[model samples]
Target chain A: MRIAELSRRSATSIPSIKYYLREGLIPGGRTTGRNQADYDEAHVRRLRLIRALVDVGGLSIAAVRDVLAAVDNPDLPGHDLLGIAHHAVSPTPARRDPDDPRWQAAREEVVTLIGERGWLVSPCSPALDVAADAIAAMRALDQADLLSSLPTYVEAVERMAAWEVAAVLARGEPARMVEGLVTGTILGEILIGALRRLAQEAESARLQGLTAPE
Target chain B: MRIAELSRRSATSIPSIKYYLREGLIPGGRTTGRNQADYDEAHVRRLRLIRALVDVGGLSIAAVRDVLAAVDNPDLPGHDLLGIAHHAVSPTPARRDPDDPRWQAAREEVVTLIGERGWLVSPCSPALDVAADAIAAMRALDQADLLSSLPTYVEAVERMAAWEVAAVLARGEPARMVEGLVTGTILGEILIGALRRLAQEAESARLQGLTAPE
Candidate 1:
């Protein structure tokens, strides 16, 4: 296969495929002749993965690079590879002034939630910051009741996360496991986010009598 | 209170506040004199809401505007208000070629999931498109197991969405109810996403024996 076929099969534009190749997001194809190259199945798979990350998972180019690097390093432990991918896709922590009481309170609440749930996350985990940022925003907006339901959200997420980790580990291939974890983590968010909204519409319709209850 | 005071109280920079004002994201304060305006507590609150939506909720400026317009329309029913907010913040649907079999299959799967769940969403809901996009991406990346777990995710999200609708409606005041739903829907995503990542870390650690189980 050539670059044109790779682009067509991967559903990516030729220019975008060239860009990914130039940026080393995908390994270079074999040199077939002067100013010509031949791509293979590996290139097609990598291109699809890159598109999935950028288009569906909303990951930045740099984040995709980091995740791909982890994917390429089969010697890395599964857990470490997952950690690198998670860190790359995690939201940037919101800035908070030291004197901001709401942020301080929210940060403390995040720590408490982690402790109460017995989650074995590090104190410095970026997820903690992301959680606190959300809490602080809720408090600032006078919508703290949203946070009051944190336990329910945590219960659902914990169960799903556990299942996800087990599923990826069950693959038994280090490279494939890492790829599963990365795609599952990022694309999984999109899936859940969309499902939640659909559920909200259904629930709202039921409440409004727009649709009868099941 | 003046623009300076609004900026200080909202913890937003003067230029940013001015930008919001210019963008009409926030209503103008009363013009009290030449080149001077008197902002009140409402302005302060609105600024905070804008910041929460933009910074923590990761909503675009256009999304923030749509949500704010919904907030201002207290006459709108709670469900309708929520619908507007949800539509605004929903992820833009990924493009799919009409001839793509994977996408067509994913679309049918999404519809089936909704039907099995007995969800009352419309056929044209953008959430459906978002879900299908995720499924298609998962299939393209050869991580279809992620979509296989869609049932579990849908069950959890449905429960949470029901609780959220009830919580918001219990607020009594239409304005407050709408505000609660908007904040909960948007900020709740951030909170859940962060919690999910934290839970994943914990699960990963336990699997790797990095932390002792309780």
Candidate 2:
């Protein structure tokens, strides 16, 4: 296949495919002549993965590069690969003042949630700080009562996470499993976020006795 | 209280409060003397809300203003108020070509899911498209098998959304309820995302026989 067919098959633009090649996000194609190259199924898959990370997952180009590097490293353990993918996708919380009492309290609350769930998470996972940051925001905003929902949220996500891990591991092939990890990590968030909003809308309508639009 | 006091209480800068005032995101303080104004506790709360929406919620200034307008409206129904807030906070998916079969298939899948769940969501809710966009991406990436998780995701979110709506309604005052709705909707996403990552880490560790860090 030529670059044109690669772009068409991958649903990516020609310019983007070229840009990705230049950025080393995707490998170069076999050059057969001047300004001519032949792409293969691998290129198509790579382009799609890159676009998924950027478009659906909302990862930065640099983050995408880092995630792809992790996926490409054959020596990296599966668990470590997931860590890199997660770190790349997770938000970099604005540094908080360590002495802020609310922050400290929220951090403890997050740790307690983990303990109660019997989740074997690393103490240093950036997600710890990210979750604490949100909890702190809830406290700062004086919505402390909403914290009660944390247990439900934790329980729900625990099951979902297990299902996700099983699905990724089921892929068998290393490359396929890594692709699944990146896609599941990023797109799963989008899926959850959007579905939550839809459910919220439905719930609100139910509470208000409002009918669906015609 | 003066602007300084308002700033200190809200943990926002004077310049930011001024910007909020200038942008009409918050109300003007009572003019006291030359270059001096008396700001009340309301000012502090409003500033905090503005910062929460901007910094934590990642809402654009214009969107924040629109959301504030909805919040400040005296006659808006609770359901309508929630509708506006959800729309404001939701991502505007890049417009899809309607004729694309994959996009069409994904959109119908979303509609079918809503029907299967008996959710009374408005047809025009942007979340419908947002969710559809994510599904389309999955199909495009050839990871359609992941779509099987939709039922689980939908069920979990339905329960969570019910709790969210109930919590917001329990706030009593319209203003407080609106505040709860916005805070819960936005921060809830951050909370869920981060928590999901933490859970995935724990699940991955369990699956790979990896030990928690010492």
Candidate 3:
């Protein structure tokens, strides 16, 4: 079938299909000279996987590439896949210098704290470190311990890991799992969207109550 | 106090402090020229906010910067913070060719889908589009539609939000909302993780029972 057919069958557009092809994220079909090319079931399957990781999983092109690479490689471990997802969700960028001592200090504190947890995280991203530094300065203003946030974070990470594992299992089969994941991911964003509003509402009320005069 | 002294006081580090200084994410502190500088409380508060946005909010620096900028602008509406956070999670790199048809179609599809949902999303990031495309492909192979998963996600997101909101309200002040967000995010992750494992168990039992009858 042609790209247009694949797009139509897949419920995607021809242009979008071409973009995937250009990115080499999707394999190309056999060229038939002029304006025609042929695709098969494999193309359909690949296109779907590409969409799942990118759209639902919220990964970058590079990140999606790594994930696809792993999924295609039979020897890859499940742990690596999860790690890839985690990395995809938390892609890092370059960093810059801090403006004050306190900002600088916060970076060190978080890195040390995260390190002490023995999670084997890569060196804190330069950007994160910079963010931490700015936070350090902020910490100076109020009297809060930098380490006070740790126990809660640990508890959270554990809970998250459990959730992902359970969600995927509900999928039944790998293909179904991908479907479930894809469905879950988009819905997950909406859920977050609604919840954020909910949280804000409650928080706003609490803030007013707490700060009100007796 | 000097950088080292502030570092000791905050339980943070020196290199991190310097890194933050360079990033321009934080403001400059008092300088004594040659080898002297002063630090204070304001720096501390900033540090905490920075750390919360990065570690807990999972925002990148560029996203964080936009947020900080908006937050600093008293004229800017506060309700938009969540929207910013939402955009922060999208991938950033742009790699599509100017004439890519498939890319354009997929991009339009995603933007339209998100908009139709009444979600106030940021401009489409091409890099994110590619990743989402991969997931889209994978989801096409699944058994369910996007709407099917909403119920589970809605319940989970709301539950977490309730717990988090309750926690903040009980704290006597709404300042811990960042903490509230963190708790909610972590709980969601954990919930997903638990569900993943439980599903696998359920499947195994069902499969075993079905096969045993034969």
What stretches of model 3 exceed 4 Å from their correct place? A30-38, A54-63, A93-160, A169-190, A203-214, B1-214
Candidate 3 i-RMS: 10.5
Q: What is the TM-score of chain A alone in each candidate?
A: 0.82, 0.86, 0.59
| Cα lDDT of model 1 by residue, B108-195, tens digit | 8988888888888877788788788778878877787755577789888988898888888788665566567667877788788889
lDDT digits (tens) for residues B1-214 of candidate 2: 9988888998999898888888887888899999999999888777767776776667899888787887788898888888887777776756677688988888889999989888988788888887888788777788887777888899899989988888888876665676677788878888898899899889988988876566
Per-residue lDDT of candidate 3, residues B76-148 (tens digit): 3323433343344444434435355654564565455544443333343332354344334334446334434
| TM-score rank order | 2, 1, 3
Give the fraction of reference interface contacts each candidate recovers: 0.81, 0.77, 0.05
lDDT, candidate 1, at B35? 93
Q: Which stretches of candidate 1 lie over 4 Å from their true place?
A: A1-69, A91-95, A98-101, A212-214, B1-76, B91-101, B212-214
- CA shift at B5, candidate 3, in angstroms? 18
Off by over 4 Å in 2: A12-39, A54-69, A72-75, A98-101, A212-214, B16-39, B58-66
Return the TM-score for each candidate structure. 0.80, 0.87, 0.45
Scored against the true structure, residue B57 in model 1 reaches a CA lDDT of 56
Worst 10 residues of 3 chain A by lDDT: A141-150
Cα error, candidate 2, residue A190 (Å) = 1.5
Top model number, TM-score: 2
Error of 2 at B154 (Å): 0.5
